[model samples]
Target: MGIRVAVAGASGYAGGELLRLIAGHPEFDLVAATAHRQAGAPVSAVHPHLAGLDLVLTATDPAGLADADLVFLALPHGESGAVAAMLPTGVKLVDIGADHRLRDAAAWRRYYGSEHAGTWTYGLPELPGQRALIAAAGRVAATGCYAVATILALAPLIAAGVVSAEDVVVVAASGTSGAGRAAKTHLLASEVMGSLAPYKVGAHQHVPEIKQATGAASLSFTPVLAPMPRGILATVTARPTSDADPADAARTALTTAYADEPFVRVLPRGSWPATAATLGSNACHLQVTADVDSGRVIVSSAVDNLGKGAAGQAVQCANLMLGLPETTGLTAFGTAP
Candidate 1:
């Protein structure tokens, strides 16, 4: 009798996380789960952690997902568009892909090398007026993992006019799960362990989306692939528009902006965010300070990429679209060892 839901890319890291979260959600009945090569396989085969979930994977088909009231398209970038177009218009959708996140067609084509798939209401509820947009949207585009962390860090300062939007810099280290479940020689255990490697130095697909969301005139993003399995630690820095104590202004902005939010926390001064503190939860932990030498505001952000960056975010949007409380089935606290 609950709201029926389906997941289209149910075998990857994000998809598996969605299934896990949905299984625990009180009002969402996961009626269908589809995958490409994972079709016909039991959920446990691919997601060993989901051994108790009894559903068998079905091939990714719009027809198979039609009965659900909502669908989460966790498909790869550029793939969700076609499937979303074929779905019945009545079924609400939350896409955890780059397919619908960008507003600029030219930017999409340049970065993804594909024709534009059009845009959807953005899914980051913490941004001003975004919760209402997500609540009213028939389809929403969830934020990229890195974008989620970086935006949450930088947006408040820009909105408060405390930081110069003309120049922003982000250097983030993300766990390997952000790379997806595909088999690549670079992701081999021996290659990844103890290695902190930076990739996509200058051009990252999330660049335009971040710019569109935060209104930053320019951003220089560098992403490092860390050895761990599931989190993101982003260091976002920006010059201050005023010479006054940017650190205090930055902290006040962040704390005020997210004070009432259920999942984003602006850590108490002197505290810092660590990837371990936000693991396995929808929570994003943040801290603000001024760099000693440059006086630029530095905001450190942390989140489980597969959680708030993808599945947990998609579910939060689904709750709003379904007229349920935003925190109905999501948790704000992360687990610790």
Candidate 2:
């Protein structure tokens, strides 16, 4: 028998993506899927692409999920912590929400306006010394989409002590899917199509997450909504520690950091990362350059917000936690036109 898997919040976009990946995984047996208001409905009713799945949506309750060996919580922020507390400690749990990503309680309360749920082992495997933690922890907190992109863009330079993290700026454009599957007036196609607008400018919740993950001294993050359905393109800039060949240093740092990482790609010189190149896959495309005149290092990174940014990331952590190969059921190649 395969490892029994259960997905909570199955009606949402991240949960649906988890379901898709679980269906394709060889070891995971998707035995239960839960949703809030959609309970008692067929899983296919909300996720048409998963029409072949025969399971009905169950209410998200601990008793209902007790049978599964592994559980994936894709619920909204402020929700997963409670559900996780109710589950058995022996079961592996991965949270794809903001509840447990931050180690500072003050930071979590400031942004989420709720009690801190306590931090879990961060789920970004490519980060230095992070894989070992994820492989041993029973609970993992997947990083946010924007946080992952920005952290991946800057961590190499910060780790190499080549960039001053005191003043960092990140401007990212994300597809509408990052906003979640909820229905809101701002997310309507009529308003979002053919328009590029910025929201949560100075106070995006992911700001502290990036700072915590990369050990950046200070950061200003601005997220823009693009007119597409998936992916995130993040442009990050920071001051370098030295003026001598900062570009070459940044490149060398990135190459050394991700040399053995399967999902992160440092692109060729003069080439830039694009959201389209990472769409529908667990890949993050990165490119870096140094502005000698301005004494700044600029890095561009791209990833599928719903893929590597959320569901794919959660799955990747799960594989490690189970002692399985990191890329067992995940893909690094995007679907091209």
Candidate 3:
């Protein structure tokens, strides 16, 4: 028998994506899929793309998920913690919610306005020693969509001493799906199309996560709501610390850090990252250069919000936790037009 798995909150965008990914994973057998509002509905009813999936959505409960070897908690922030605590101790968990990603309880309480859910082994494998940590962990917190995009672009620079941690600025644009599958007036087709709206200008929830993962002491984060359906394009700029040419140094740091990574691609010089190139894949496309006039180092990173940022990330960690190859059933190639 294959590794038995389950997904909680399978009706939402990320959850549906998780269902889709798990369906294709050869060694992972999806045993149960649970949802709150969509309980008793067939999985295909909520996720039309998963039409052939014969499973019916059950209510999100520990008992329904306990039989699985691993469970992916895709419930929204503040909900996963309660359910997670009740799950069987033998089941490995990967939470794609914001509940368990922060290390500092104070930060968690301040941002989420609730008690800390406690930290899990962070699920960004590209980070130093993180792959091993995820493999050894029973619980892993998948990196936030925005957090992964920014961290992948910023961490190597700070770790290599090519950029100063004190002053870092990131302006990121994310497709509307990052807002989740809920119906909000602001997310209306008319409101988002042809418009780039900036929200959570300074106090984005991912700010703390980015700093914790990248070693950035201070950050100015601006997140934009794009009109499309998926992907994140983040432009990160930081003060250069070395005398070496900023572009060369930043590229060297990024390339060196991700040299052995299967999912991170440091694009060739003069080529920049775009959201489309990373669509439908777990790849993070990156390109680095220096602002000729300001001498500041700039790195542009792109990723599919549902892929490297959430569902795919959870699957990667689950693979490690289950003693499977890190790249098992995962791909770096994106579907581009």
Q: Across residues 1-337, which tens digit of lDDT does each residue of candidate 3 receive?
A: 8999999999999999999999999998999999988899999989999999999999988999999999999998999999999987888999999999999999998888999989898999999999999999999999999999999999999999999999899999999999999999999999999999999888999999999999999999999999999999999999999788888988888999999999999998788899999988999999998888899999999999999999999999999999999888889999959
Error of 1 at 21 (Å): 0.5
**Candidate 2: count of backbone clashes, pairs at least 3 residues apart or interchain:** 0
So what's the TM-score on candidate 3? 0.99
Q: Candidate 2 has which clashing residue pairs, if any?
A: none
Model 2 C-alpha lDDT per residue in residues 181-261, reported as the tens digit of each score: 889999999999999999998999999899998989899888999999999999999998985788899999999999999
Report how far off residue 13 is in candidate 2 (Å). 0.7
TM-score of every model versus the real structure: 0.99, 0.98, 0.99
Tens-digit per-residue lDDT, 220-245, candidate 1? 99999999999999999999999888
RMSD of 1: 0.7
Sliding window of 10 residues with minimal summed lDDT for model 3: 242-251
List per-prediction Cα lDDT, in the order shown: 0.94, 0.92, 0.94
